[model samples]
Target: MLPSNTLPNPAILARPRRRRSPMTLGAAFGLVLALVGGGAWLATRTPIVNLGNEQQLSDSGLLQAWKDGAVIVMIRHAERCDAAPGPCLAEPDGITVAGSQAAQRVGQGLHELGLNGADLLSSPKLRTRQTAHFILGQALASADWLGTCDPQFPAEAMAHKRPGHNLVLVTHNGCIDHFARQQHVPGGERASGYASALFVSLDGSGKARILGRLNEPDWQRVLASSGR
Candidate 1:
C-alpha cells in the first residue's frame, strides 16, 4: 500500500472542507500524487499555497528556512521542446529558447535567495539536465531517482538533502507532484507550471514540511516582497 499523506496544517487549509458532491474518474485520479518506492510505484496526499502572492511569500517562513539552510526546492523543467509548436532549443527532447531564458530568470531568483551553501541537482533526462544547466550556467549532478519519479521519491529526496546546505532539483511535474502529495497537498494546489518551483524543508526534527510554490512569472514580486 502507498504511504498516506498527512493532513496539512490549519493555516494552510484554514478554509472549511466541502462535502463531496460528485467526481469523474479522471478527476478522482488527479487527486492522487504518484510515487515509486521499493521497486514499486504508488500514489500519495494535501494542500499547497501560492507563494507567488507577495503577502503569502512574506508570511511563508521560506526565507527563514533558507537562512537556516533547511530547504529543498523542486523546480519543474522549463517548457519542453516537443510540448509546444514553437522553436526548440537544440533538440526535440530539450527545452525551447524561451524556456532557457526562463531558467536563467529562475536562477536569478535563486541567486537572490543565495547559493553559497547550496547544491544543485537534476533528473538525468535531457530536458531536466538542460534546465539545470541554464539555471546555474553549468551542468548539475544528475541522478536516476530524480528522473525516475517513483514512490521512493520522498525518501530519495530526503536522502539527497544535506544539512546546512540548501538543495535544488530540476525534475518533471509528476515527480514534483509526488512530493507535494506526500505532504498531503489539497487537490486544488496542483498546477506546477514550466520552471515552477515547490519549496520544502527538512530540519533537525527530520520532518519534511511544505513551504510554498512559486510559479515562473512570480519571481519579481516575490523578490520585492521577500526583501532577500
Candidate 2:
C-alpha cells in the first residue's frame, strides 16, 4: 500500500460523470413554453365585468332613472349578416332576420319605459342603424363618434345629453368595450352579447359611472317582473 501521505493516481480517483437525458431536457423546455403560452393567453383575454349580486337593477328602477335623465344607455347592435365567414364589403352588413326580431323586442321593452323622453343616436354601420330603427320604430341620428371605437365617444355622448332627456346610443361591441375601458369601469365584465345594454349614470359634474349591464335575457326578466 502506498504511504498515507502519498497522492493517488488521478486517473484511478476520477469519478464517472453523470449525463442528463435528452427527454428530461425536452420536457423542461416544453413546460417552460406551456407556461409562457398560458400567460400570453391570459394577458390577451377579454376582461369579464364583475357586476356584484346586488347590482342587478329592477325594471322600474331603470325606467325611473331614465325618466330622471340620469341614465345613458349604450347598446350593441344585433347580430350581423352570417351568410359567410369573414368581413363583407359588397354591401353594408345588415342584421339577420332573427336579429331584427330581437331588436323589435328590445324596442318594445324600451317603449314600455316610454322612449319619448329619450334622444336616440346610432353608429353609421348598417347593422346598428337597423337595430336602432327596429327598436325605436323611427330613424335615429347617426354620429361618427358612435361609429368607431374612439376613446372620446363616451365623453361626447355625455356632452350630448340633454336635460330631462336620456341619451340612447346604438353602437357596436368594440365601441362599448373601449368606452368601458376608458371609463375604468371595474368588473370582470365579459363582452356584451348582441343587443345588451350598458346603463351609465352621469353626475351633475358630467362624470360618467357604469351602473350595470342589462343583457338580452335580463330584459325579458325585467319585463316579466314588471308584468309588462
Which candidate number maximizes lDDT?
1
List where candidate 2 sits over 4 angstroms from the true fold: 1-55, 59-61, 83-92, 186-190
lDDT (10s digit) by residue, model 2, range 141-166: 89988987777876787888887788
Show the lowest summed lDDT stretch of 10 residues, model 1.
33-42
Q: For residues 49-163, what per-residue lDDT tens digits would candidate 1 score against the true structure? A: 7889888887888999999999999999999999988789999999999999999999899889999979888999999998999988898889999999987898899998899
Candidate 2 TM-score versus the reference = 0.69
For residue 86, what is the lDDT in candidate 1?
79
**What TM-score against the true fold does each predicted structure earn?**
0.78, 0.69
Model 2, global lDDT? 0.75
Candidate 1 wrong stretches, greater than 4 Å: 1-45
